[model samples]
Target chain A: MSSSTPHALAESLCILTLKSGIWVLFPITVVMIMVGILRHYIVLMLQSPPKKQPRAAIREQRALIRSQIIRATSANSPIPPTYYKSISQHLSQAFADGTYLKDGPPKGDAPAPTAPNPLTDPAAMDGMMAGMKTQMVMMVPQMVIMGWINFFFQGFVLIKLPFPLTLGFKSMLQRGVETPDMDVRWVSSLSWYFLNFFGLNGLYRLILGGENSADSSRDMTTPFAAAANIAQPGQAQDFNKLFKAERDNLEFAEGLYSWVGKDVDTRILKKYGRLPGEVPR
Target chain B: MDLTTSLQKLAAYRPKQSQKSKETFEKGVALLEHGGYLKQGDEGWDALERLALAALDQDNLEVADRCLELIAERFPGSPRVDCLIGIRMEATESPDVVLKYYDELLEADSSNAAAWRRKVSVLRKMGKVDRAVEELSALLDTFYTDVEGWLELADLYASCSQYVPILLISDAQNLMSARYTYALQSLSHALLLAPQNPSHFLQFAETAYLAGDITLSLKMFLTVVDMTDDDDGDVSPSDSIPTGMTLRAWFGVKLCTRRLLTEPRLLTSSGSQTPAPSSSNISTLDDLSTERLRTAYLDIKNESPPATEKELIAVLATLIK
Candidate 1:
């Protein structure tokens, strides 16, 4: 109808001048800066230093970490065969004795790898709290700024990007601005705000270092999130079973020099032009 | 050779000038003979294995028999005891009997790395290179992370080219082994999966040089040469390199320096090599020279270079920046 409306000629042109780019850019830039500042302070207030564990607990956790490392990096030369067996056997026995177990063995046949109630664990709760805090820092700002844009610039077609996009993105690009016939290349205000949010990762990295918790786009990838996911509530695996699996893995581990155990020196010598046999024989 | 005299010769050939008497071995034997290890489970088993093997090697069947008895009595079902039994058989039985014994052990527990290792070595001793290759492959199929199996497989290929078993003692035999290009692929895997072993770098450098990858070889060789100088009380003295290791590194550096100077880098390959040159090449000509490495080696031997793993890493990290 606007195409044929003669009296509203100048307004009906609907051509956004290049100067209007500044209006969109100014708002987006302000939103990005505000979001970043809010993100830092909120995350700071939310953070708590990891809870200090007793010495025995520390030793037990370290033992688990060490065992895990041994399993992961067994191919590395640091864990010779002797070390492999000794650590596995000691841990296996300790696991059997329930030395570091918080509670008595549950009443069941071949108990599950995890304890039944990780939700009750203080450590796991702490992890969940941390995860929720990071998510809050990321989601709350985008939502607030998006609401602001919707309230003020609901129908404004901010700017057309240099690149062409398919019509499949129309629902996304012209979200609040229900221009049924507008080109997909022309992005609305809310859509342009999201574009800056996702595309400014490199800029954020340049200013905030590679591992800032403020990058809401990276919410799921933060170490806190990962740790929380791993320590799922009511889910704790049995250390006994863990030790057994590790023992099997290590038993089969190839000790790079174990084949000819004592012949390591002889093998090297032979490779470098020494005798295949003993040196002084 | 007599075990005492052979050990004495090894000590002499070592960079350290320490001399050993027959008493040291006896003292070690006496320590194990004590009942202390019997109370400790894992340590007890290891001590028993060590004593048993030493006793077997020294032809002291009585002590070996006692150690083996203790092992069997303590850990009745361990594959380790079975492995000790296999070693005893290798020492006493015929080749075919030992082969059959290992096969039976493998049938009982295919995942027993010790039995599998003994089987491969026995196959190699019998000149069954193809079968050894097959068995080694099977072993590696289950355990690809092991560096030793890769090295052994590489050795098997090298042997196929010119395997003069008796020539293994001669210095000139290096010429024969260096020509096996087939092992280069396997060595690449070794280099990729190699961990914190500085010796692997030395070995890889030597093999790479033989394979004519002058750039990678030079980089690895320089890394080896640098890593061997590590000593700041941080690393255990047991890991300290003797004079021989440095001399071998020096030979590689000298060859690398002369080759880099005489060779045209751009012409070896196409435009691919031009875009990125070796970091060692970009380093100062003084750093790449044979004289500098020799002087460095001498300083290590004489003044004791205050190099730790951290120190050399710092030096290497700053190579470009």
Candidate 2:
């Protein structure tokens, strides 16, 4: 094989080899597609319904949202000045007093210097378990499929591409095949399986709608990225700190606040050239 | 319409205040009875829920029960479905039963917004207005961005104001003003959340007018007129007549201006904190509003019968005079 040119060696492929290559390619591709469809349904079945947060949790979230709204709308707020002052003062006082804390004030006079262990909190543990379950649902089938392909099709050259590839692709396209003299276009079965794994995303989207969970490419990267997050997934927010931050935001907004509707009569009059000696400012 | 088309239409139809519930119930039942919408998947469930509400509205308890049963079977132990069950109970059962059901649902999921709102409505329906107000205020504290909740709270406050008797003039006046103040505050929150909606601004203006702040009311009315004014800049101010909310706002502007001119002390009064329009600006606004009202009335007169046109013209003459 080293004595022959790559072009001539590619042309010399026998009928039996090509037939075996087709046999290796056909079942893997079909089984992969079937597994993808099955995985979509299985993930759907295994997914848990979203749990509603408790009342205090919702109030904490909405209180933050209300402060953000005030910050965003302060420059051109339509709320009158008196009402604006009262609500802002009320929110600032509430935030300082921890009136909207989810689990109430800390037992001690001060919050702990370090965050509490999330694993010790039952609610946080439940959240982590939920995250882990979804991660498992996404990951388990992929490992099984990869392992099956590796076991059954080890060292098998699946197919050669029509277009020539550079020598740089040899390690990627000939993963289990160790022959150095083989043309770079010759792909191993495992390499083909990896290609199908990443490339079938669009196919799944075509078969299922856009929101289907069949696409497993993200699972490859998410496990490592989410490992650190899984320990404290959506742990109870520190409302005291958040409230202090929002109080500062609301105080900062007070200096910038101006009611947009304050001068509407003159503004509209000037808009239609109705107000005397005034331009449409 | 055929079964498929009518089913699709009924499934997609959103209920509005003016929608005929009886007709909706009939159409919804005709399709839903045989599960014609089942193939529509999620939309079928939506149609079922809407039909249940329509059936409840029309007092068709049997059909409503069937729809609710199907939905509850599909989504067992769901808070949303539980709220729908509570609403169904509200139609037939006493207020106490409905309230208990809502309380149980809330106990299961405290943040169930629908269940909380239903509990408040049940309290209101039972003529426990103060209790309803307390519950609703607490609900709003949690669901601060709920624009409809704020509007409903404002309406309840207004209703409370109206319920005060005139026999105790001083107490009624004080209580009435206090209630209107609360209503105004609630409406202000609604305005903060949805500033682009002209109707909220109109509501604020009307509430301010009722609260005896003619200055603030006039400004809000003018804001509404500005918001709803759709004509391009090319139309001369004299040639353009306001319509719809703008027409209503023009009437508001007329009312505010008349009151302000008759009692100019409303501007200098300590109770009215908003910056007042000048006497000259008020007179000009009055003229502009009167001109617009005259054009709107004349346009209406042109569309009326000959006999009513004369009467309308006479009324218009007296109105602008």
Candidate 3:
């Protein structure tokens, strides 16, 4: 091939490669994510094990009912649960006084399968692992998208204007009174009252509005700075004494006042036999 | 004349003598001996005076009235009948009417402070307190040096709870006998007037303590202790209260009690004095005004949070003593 032709072909290949990459992988990944989420929802909704009744089902039911009866007998007094026939007879016994003995070994069932071995039903385990991985992969992108939608949605509701050109008219209306020599005293003064009247209403509305914000974290710091090293031997003694004296006086006065309407004041007056205002020359 | 012989002679001459003559005789005797049976200068005076006394003794009001009437008609210038009439009016009428007669007696004899005092008592009994006060004022104005009048006026003011007036009146009279009422009222008013004078203020409070207003006493005591310099000289009441307690000392004891018991530090202020109660708690509050203090104590005792009766009594003892 000629040199120019080779160069043109190389440029065309680069363009084609970029277009194919975008077209093929991106769409496939999006489709796979959608499918995985749908599968999770369906499985969560439908999953339940099939029941296999033993040949000695009636004997087993009697034994279960006996144990349930024992539990019900020891249940707290004063209320008998309502009966229902659709539930098992043993459950009925347990339900009689609303007493329930939680089933399963006390120490928890056997350890979870250590490894994905066929004997431990590897297929179910594999499916659970796959679901968990899919959940982990989807979490970050899902959060980013949710945040984006919330931010834009709030912005749209918060800031609505008729058109870009109308902003100029609005700004002029806001600044019109500011031009020199025009008496906009009424406009300027009344603006505060009007804005306050409605601004308060809007602020109250915002506070009571549905919460969609990040949780706040508490600060974990000591209140006082450590650098003030000076100490006074009797710093608070006088203040404490004054505080205690005032507090005691107030308490006594309160007690005295309760007994007599301002009689305590009179009593204090009587005790002091003098007014606080009088200073002996 | 001998009273019995004169009475017999009047009885024998009553039928023979005119009623006017008997009244004249009674008036003549009455002038010389104010409570005599008969007048020496007149006819039939002995019989009438004898008859009046006999009628008054018999409680025969009608006869007494007739005898007094005859005496008055027969001896117009004689005041014996008026005196007799006043006695009869006081005995027969309500206090208000008696007061009127007493007032008349005072008018007739301006110097009759006895009559004025009687009138004051009658007015008071009739609930005419202002009239009683008026009578007292008259006595005070006319008889300024009369200690009796001053004492009576002081009593009247005290009965009415007019403390400040009582204090002023007592101080004016210089009647130290009224120290309790005088001290309390004066101290209270002084506190109101000159609250900053710790010494002067405490003096009145001390007097109140002497007067048996324990709460006020305690207050004044504590105030003195709080306001006075440690080296301040003791000022004692010049006229010692009759109860043998000085206002200053009583207040000091009360101050010491409250301080030692309520605030331990106060006990230490008087060094070497233990925080324990004195050798004896305050004894009986025997002063007349102590009832008011007792009432205040009981009122406060009731309001204190549920305590045993003994505890209440203890608190009350603190207040009254």
> RMSD of model 2, in Å?
5.2
Which ranges of candidate 2 are over 4 A from the true structure? Answer: A1-14, A105-113, A131-140, A226-233, A278-281, B1-19, B161-170, B231-234, B270-272, B303-321
lDDT, residue A116, model 1: 48
Candidate 3 off by > 4 Å: A1-281, B1-88, B161-321
Docking quality tier of candidate 3? Answer: incorrect
User: What does candidate 2's lDDT look like per residue over B1-321, in tens digits?
Assistant: 343333323322333434577777889999986787677888888788878989887778999999998999998976567767777888789999888887887887787777788788788878888888999999999988878889989999998744434553476557777778789999988988888899999999988888888888898899888888864666755567677788888888888888898898888652448888878888888877776776787686564323433353347545433
Q: Give the count of colliding residue pairs in each prediction.
A: 12, 0, 22
In candidate 1, position B68 carries an lDDT of 82
Weakest 10 consecutive residues of candidate 2 chain B by summed lDDT: B6-15
Residue A218, candidate 2: how far off, in angstroms? 1.6
DockQ of candidate model 2: 0.57
Tell me the spans in candidate 1 whose CA falls farther than 4 Å from its real position: A1-281, B1-25, B31-42, B159-179, B225-251, B263-287, B296-321
* TM-score for the A-chain in each candidate structure: 0.68, 0.83, 0.18
> How displaced is residue A280 in candidate 1, in Å?
46
Best by lDDT: 2
lDDT of 1 at A161: 70
Colliding pairs, model 2: none
The deviation in Å at residue B300 for candidate 3 is: 30
lDDT of 3 at B239: 16
